[model samples]
Structure formats: C-alpha cells, structure tokens
Target: MGAEQNWIPTEIGPADVGAEATPYGLIDHLQRLEDLTGLLTREKALVFRGFGVTPGELDKVFDLLLPNRLAYVHGNSPRTKVGQNLYTSTEYPQEFTISMHNEMSYAHQWPARLAFYCEVAAETGGATPVVDGVRWLAALDPEVREAFAGGVRYLQNLHDGYGFGKSWQQTFETDSREEVEAFLAGTEATWEWKKDGGLRVAQLRPATTRHPVTGTEVWFNQADQWHPAGLGDETAATLASIMPVEDLPQSVTLADGSPIPAEWVEQIRDRGLDEAVNVDWRPGDVLLIDNVLVGHGRRPFTGSRRVLVAMSD
Candidate 1:
C-alpha cells in the first residue's frame, strides 16, 4: 500500500490547526470541526498531541470525543474503573507485550469508538501500537484465514468470587445472578453454572467483519488472544499443568470444536504486531480511534504509565 493509504493513525497538533497549546484551544478546534466521525472513519485513528489536558479536564474532552461513553462490561482485561464510564487501560504486567486485536471482537456487541488519554507517560518503551485491520487481514496466511472461515468459539470460566481471571460479578459488573442472566438473554451465548461456583460462558463469532460505513472487510476476531498457543510456551505449559483446557480461565476453538494450530496462532499474533504503527505516549496526549478499523496493543515498558480509556457505540 502507498504511504498515504498505509498511515494507520493521523496525528494532529496545536500548530497544525493554529490553536493554542491548551485544552480549551483543543476543545474549540474540535467544536468548530465538521464531521468529526467522518474524519475518524477515514483516518482510522487520530492522535491529539500538545494539548496539555489535565486529569480534571479529561471528562470534558471525552464528552466530545466519545459521545455517550459506555461502561466496560463483559471485558476480559484487568482494569480499574476510575470515573463514570471511564477505566484504566489494561492493568496487565509492564514487562509483557499485549497482542493486537480489535477490542471485544469475540463478543456479540462491541464499542465502535475508543478514546485514550495518557495521564503519565512511561519511563521507557511503552507505546500503544495500532494496526490497520485491513492490512492485518492481508498479512495473514491464506490457510490461516481459511481455518477461521467457519467462525470461532470463545470460552470463559469466571468464578463466583475468586478465580484465575475475573469473577462473574466483575465480568458483568453486577452482583445479581438475575441481572447476568438477563444480559446474556440478548446474546447468542450459552452459560452453565459450575458445581464449584463458577460460570462457564461460550460464544461463537465471525472471524471477519465489514465496516458499517466503508464496507471494508477486516480481521475481527480474538482467536489468537484467547488461544493457548499464543500465550508463550512457558505460560501455556504452566496453565496446562494447573488445569485442563476446558477449565482454563479462557480458551478458544473453531466453531466446529476443532483445534486452531499453534503456527496459525503465532502467525496471527506476529503479523498484526508486525504491521502495527506505534503511538508513543506523552503526558496529556489523547488518541481517538475507530475501533472497527484499527486493532491496538501495548509494548513492554518500564516505570509508571497511566493511560485512561473510554468507549462509545
């Protein structure tokens, strides 16, 4: 692809629009801009830099960037809710790199837009890498793509109060079993309450999806993230030694209950990362992305990195 077409995220700075390097100036520019959604769709991702927006001023910024911010319900990543419909971006270890995937692609429904704000930049090596989903799909091997043609099944085993992953209450953000059942009633999912006070939920989703506006087909599954083969050999082996595959915190398989090969899993993970463009963090910087068009992940870092995220449909 040409350079213009391959640019995953288009960056904007105060100087680019002749605005002051302040939050109010950024807000004024955003208010005056026409068709913000259309611009986001065309660019896939946008980085708002040199704004000097503080934590106290983030809500106002988010209100414009993410209209009708949604709660992080049914999320698998570890995060802390810090404000109304706002969360700390994945609390995964600082030493481990997260693989690229469209947010919540395995679910029946997902956010259409995501906004991230960097409150504190890491000391070294922490960058949010974004990949064009179209490029990611094109990078995958034909055999691997065909293997997922029929769709994939995602399995989650959430405990009542304590477990390897999240608890059922935490996953659904509710303490009521009736509420959880009500939510699941609307999805194409099956759930079973285990004798050990755990909940096993399974969902089947397509491997690829077309953008609602552009109609561009993109890779849109979390098979690599959910599969044991993508976890690194040491971690996978430790999990295997602890429990059987079925009882693992999370797992995935083909729609027909067939195994996805390890090589395919590795390819999916590697190719997406290989095609990604890293967005290095700076305190007060903000990023807005069309979640369907771009997949995001994190690189290993040192020191403290505090990035907050919010989403909207």
Candidate 2:
C-alpha cells in the first residue's frame, strides 16, 4: 500500500520558525491580513499579534489553524472532556500551567495535528511543554509498545459534577441512552465501563501512526489506564462492573495476576505533565499544538477564563 504523504502547506510567505529574526515582514503582513484560513490548515499554525479583527476573523483563523482533520482548539473544549479546574476557584486565572496530549485520544476519530497560540501570558506559571508522542512511545519496551499498537488502551474521565458534576450521561448532550452508548462506542474503537459507574474502556489501535507528512508513528493511547488494577477483590469487581466490559472478555490484569504498579501510573502522569504545553490567555489568544506529536492540559486558575474552541479533520 502507498504511504500517506499528502501535505498541504499554508500560504503564509516564508515564515520559518527556524529563522533567527522575528520575521517582522511576516508579522506586519499578518496583522493586516484579515482572513488566515487560506494560510492555516493541516499545514501549520501562524502565531501572530496586532490584528484589529473580530471573532469572525478568529473563526476563520481557527479553521485555518487546525489540521486538515481537526479545527483549531483551545484548552477549555478539550478539558471539558478530560478534566480541568475552572478559573472561578483560583486567585489568578492567568497564572496557570497545562500539559500536552492529542485533542481526543479516547475518541477513535482523533485529529491528525494540533496547533495553539498564546494571547495572554500570565505574570507567573503559564508556560507550555511539548514532547514528541512517537518518541515517548518508542522508548518503551518493544513488546510493551507493540501491545499498545494493537489498539488495546483505556481511559478514566472523572465527572463528579464540579461545575456540572453529574454523571457523563447527564453531562454530554445526546438524544437518549442508545445515542449515549453509541457515542461512547466509537465505531473505530471499543470500550467497557468501570464498576463505580465510571467509564473505563479500551480499544485497539496502531502503536505508530505515521504522520501524513512527517511519516512518524505517534504514540496515541493511554495504556497504563487500560490495564486492570488488582485491588481488593470487591473493589476490582465493582470497578469491572462500572467499566466497559464488552471487549475485556477477562478482567484487566497486569503481566501477571498482580495489581498494576504505581510506577506506571506515575510514568504516565509524569510524561503527561512533562510533555504538555500550556497557555494562559486574554480571551482572544488562540492556541494550537501539533497533536500527533504532543499533549496538552490546563492548571488551576481564578476568575472566568472564557474560551471558545473547535476541531476538524
């Protein structure tokens, strides 16, 4: 089969990140440039400032900013699905950090690339971290990485209704139970529920998905979360009941019939934290990250951090 190398570069002049200068010429042109949609896309993110534009322009910019498969996205939209602390509780909404990850690793139809920008930098604690997802996955034992390539992965998203702390069923918008189940049951993936009425599920996917242009197999799943934790018998069973069991014929187990090692969880957390990129904003700042190679997250903040987001293929 032919490898996918279909790359479409944005028409933003010679804006090389490799350039030593700020590329003042590019910036000046970009500011007056009303619509960036033609210049943004599955190609690259054009981060510039001084645009006396409206949200409509921003929308067009987002459309251009996203990968061909996904649209431009911000921290709020993704976090709503994963989990995040709202600004209301924190003292400074601007002073927060974030992690890195693809837009929707849990969902089967994840975007191919991601991009982000910074509109407002906090006085403190708002730096972004990024790591190549493929490199991180390759660092694992060949076998362990191979197992992941098979698409056997899982995730646990807590929804205690902090803002809408209701169960996912209540949180997500859908027509009925069937729609909800269907939504949860990714056509390109599979999953099971946790016993605590939480959704702990897994699906099989390739380990190294080559970036269309980069031709790199990116690590795309959270395996540590998928493996079963042999907690107390009762607890395990309860967790199993609440978790999605359609694909997990047998209970999730470690390499042996042992509880999952704490180190693995720590590893995942450490990787997620270390590799993530964060941005504190001033409402209009649109951010984008290369999803195939990086992860993302938000830290605690104060006040209302209202942000809009979108993703596309």
**Going through the candidates in order, what is the number of backbone clashes in each?**
0, 52
Candidate 1 TM-score, C-alpha based: 0.98
Give one digit per residue, the lDDT tens place, for model 2 in 1-313. Answer: 1222222122232334322123343334545656554343233343343332234355455544542433222111223421111111112235533333455564556665444434344444444444456445644556555434444343334342332123445334432546656765654444455555544333444435666666656666544434433222464467578655433423333322233354553455456565343433543454445556555555655443444444555
Candidate 2's C-alpha runs over 4 A off are 1-46, 50-56, 66-98, 115-123, 138-150, 155-166, 170-172, 181-202, 224-260, 272-284, 299-307
Off-target runs (Cα >4 Å) in candidate 1 are 1-5
Cα RMSD of predicted structure 2: 8.9
Per-residue lDDT over 78-189 for candidate 1, one digit per residue giving the tens place of the 0 to 100 score: 9999998999999999999999999999989999999999999999999999999888998998988888999999999999897788999999999998899998889899
Considering only N, C-alpha and C atoms within 3 Å, which residue pairs clash in candidate 1? none
